[model samples]
Target: MTGIAAPGTKVAVTGAAGFIGSHLVEALLGRGCEVVGIDRRSLRSQTLARLHLGDVLDHPRFSWVEGDLTDLNLNEVVDGCMYVFHLAAVPGVRSSWTGFEDYIASNVVATERLLRACREAGTPKLVFASSSSVYGMVDTLSAENDVAMPVSPYGVTKLAGEQICLAYAKRPDSRLSVTALRYFTVYGPRQRPDMAIARILAAALTGEQYTIFGDGTERREFTYVDDVVEATIAAAGVDVPAAVINIGGGSSVSMIDVIGLAREVTGNPVPLTAVPAQPGDVRATAANLSMARLLLGYQPRTDLRTGMTRHAGWMRGLTPHLLRTYAPPPMITGPKEATCSH
Candidate 1:
């Protein structure tokens, strides 16, 4: 948590109101660094309010900009900042199938604009929030150097964004240094309601049937959000000009097993209805953390059971009506349908 950046140094977080971004902003402020948060969500948006940032939202060290990354004045956002964590993107795989244009604008074009502004402002470091989706369906644990054969449009845009960062870093005159972290299945408190764990928890709490897109056998490396934030902060301190590293939980677990664990944690056995596998949905994803260890000394601390238990506990405290309200609409298959978190 310490040595994230110089104390009192200004840092900018693009998706400050998001689950992971909100955690990162809080951590940075706790470390005595000033944070400039940029998000398209209005101050009154439920997304921001539900985070319960409270004092952190009004902290003297925190300032928020209510605007999209595409239209924001990037130069001003990065001005006098030592680091920038680019986490803004139109997240979710299911929605990306029909919303490719929005994905490109948020993930690709917006990243290019930020990189250019960093180059112009001489920002020292930028940690891009890449995703394991970029690896698509891999035969074994995905490494940083593996071919980025992204299967989904969301994955494609994220890969392009990372490429843009590297392209800028390779410039002879560029002063900005970039580190892209391909996070695998990040989850914990404040997880988006649409994600697997959150949905499972909600079903357990409400006695509702949880929909499983595929059989419970699909596996994923569920990295905890706190561990991811640690890796991200560590990435900024590294000297790498341009490097891609995997930020994973150091292990993988089956979706069915996760459901069982949720039942044990929440003490509620929720019914599950399995559906056919959807397009662009990978059967498995695991990350090789060697590069992350070498570069950032990062190691995931939370196990799936422990993390899921915490998520269940957080959900138990929320009002039942609010849980239902946050749940995304039922999934229907079509060329436009897609799902999953980044």
Candidate 2:
């Protein structure tokens, strides 16, 4: 497959300050690409602090446009970009129950507007960061061909994202192509604080009780952050039709097993507690990476233990209190102050 990126290639990323987005930006810069990023968090704000973006925050090749995708000039983010990575959107299955409106605005409506912008800007490709939740509970491996019966509002919105991409790509006059990656339980250093791995590691650091929502046997295909980032870049580079592909580590393990890895990595195990499973929580997830391999030449290289060790080591550098006190940026719908460096 032909790849599009090269040194000095222009790229745009939404959710630039986020866990995966931050890592992607750093990787692109490492490849000598000039990157423009959009996120709701301000560079000067300490509220939504994440250590992942530290390396690229001041890199001359990186410029951040601050604000939600809906609030920003969509063309400004995607214009003249060879590839646009659309990773913006609120995440979490449980919270989707209560915050459905925010999911619609961020995940669905913002997506349509961004699609329009990409079409108008004539961007070659868009890589959307979708989720494994779109498959609901899968007894075996979740495939791109699986019936996407998303159990939560968040999943529904993500499926909406994939559909919207297909819809636009098929338009007779459209120039924008899209690749939607269904990431299966991405975990690594600076993972979103709400994710189980991050919360478990944080609890380990603080010696707090890490609660498991259900019996700890629920399993996930926890792809490493770096692996996810690699697949994302490949999606942008490989010349392929607009498609949905799974990005996973190919190793599925239980929550209890991950906790064991954390203990081995950190040498400090948090007290584990359990409760009945909540609504929309899946029993297990494993990704079918066949399409990723065939289409994007993707292969996941990180094992769970090694990935956990790297994650633990990265978190050890920061203050312990930062993990225990993370507040998600307020879900934005209306236009906020959109001024920033271009």
Candidate 3:
């Protein structure tokens, strides 16, 4: 695969301040594409905050726009940009149960708005950041072809967003070549504070007790952030009309193994608490990435242990609050607690 973009290929990335979004921006910059990043959150991650203050956005080839995806001026951002990487959304399956409206607006309505704007603007290609949670709870070995019975409102909204992309791409005179990359458990440096393995293991490293919901049996294919970014960039450059491809690390690991890895990575034996599983919690998820392999020439090179260690190392330098290890409140018994347990 050609890892470099030709000159003058401006790329627009939504959710640019986010974990996945920031990585995508960095990747696009490395590939020599002039980038325009749009996001609402500012100074969330310290690394990102450093990048923010470093005037990276002020580069001759880089620009930053601060706004919600649904409310942004799409034409201005989309102008002169041939590739759009849509990663902005209300995240977490459990959060959707209590806040369905946010999910609807951010995940579904925002995507629809973007698709409409792209259609109107004649953008040539768009790569959507989708979630594997659309599969929800399923039998072991969940594949792309399996029925997508999303158990969470977030999943439903994401699935709806993918449908919107495909439907928009199918327009008779559409200039868009849309591809939805369903990511599974993305983790690495700058992982969100609420993510599962990172939170659990990072807490252990800081001498904090962590809660393990659902007896640690739930399994997931935790793709590294870098791999997901690679796949996203690949999908964006592809000429495929409309495709749904799984972006995963291609291996399933249980919560127990994640805790074990955390212990190993942290070199600390932390206290643990067991809680009942919350709503929208899945039993297991494993992506069959054959479609992505054939279409995007994608390969996941980072294993969970290695990725977790990298996150742990990065977390060590940040404040304990970012790791959720700094004197956190009692275990949250609410439904939203289990939403991000990848």
Top TM-score model: 1
Ranking by lDDT: 1, 2, 3
Top candidate when judged by lDDT against the true structure: 1
Flag the better candidate by TM-score, 2 or 3.
3
lDDT of each: 0.84, 0.81, 0.79
Per-residue C-alpha lDDT of model 3 across residues 25-105, encoded as one tens digit per residue: 877887788998888776545455454335456567778888887788888778877888999988987777887888899
lDDT of 1: 0.84
What are the TM-scores, per candidate, against the unseen true structure?
0.96, 0.92, 0.93
lDDT of 1 by residue, 141-233 (tens): 999988889888888999999999999999998888999989898888888777788888888888777788887899989998989988898
Candidate that beats the other on lDDT, 2 or 3, i.e. the better one: 2
Clashes of each: 2, 0, 1
* Reference-based TM-score, model 1: 0.96
Model 3 deviation from the true structure expressed as Cα RMSD, one decimal place:
2.3
RMSD for each model, in Å, please? 1.5, 5.6, 2.3
lDDT of 3 at 104: 92
Clashing pairs in 1: 94-338, 94-339
Tens digit per residue, CA lDDT, model 2, 1-342: 334457999999898888889988988898889999888877777544436577777899998788887787888778889888999888888777776788899999999999999899888788999999899877998889989998877789999988999899889887778899999888887787767787777778777777676688988889999898888988886566678899999888998998888888899976776666777788888989999999888888999999989988877876746755532223222222010000
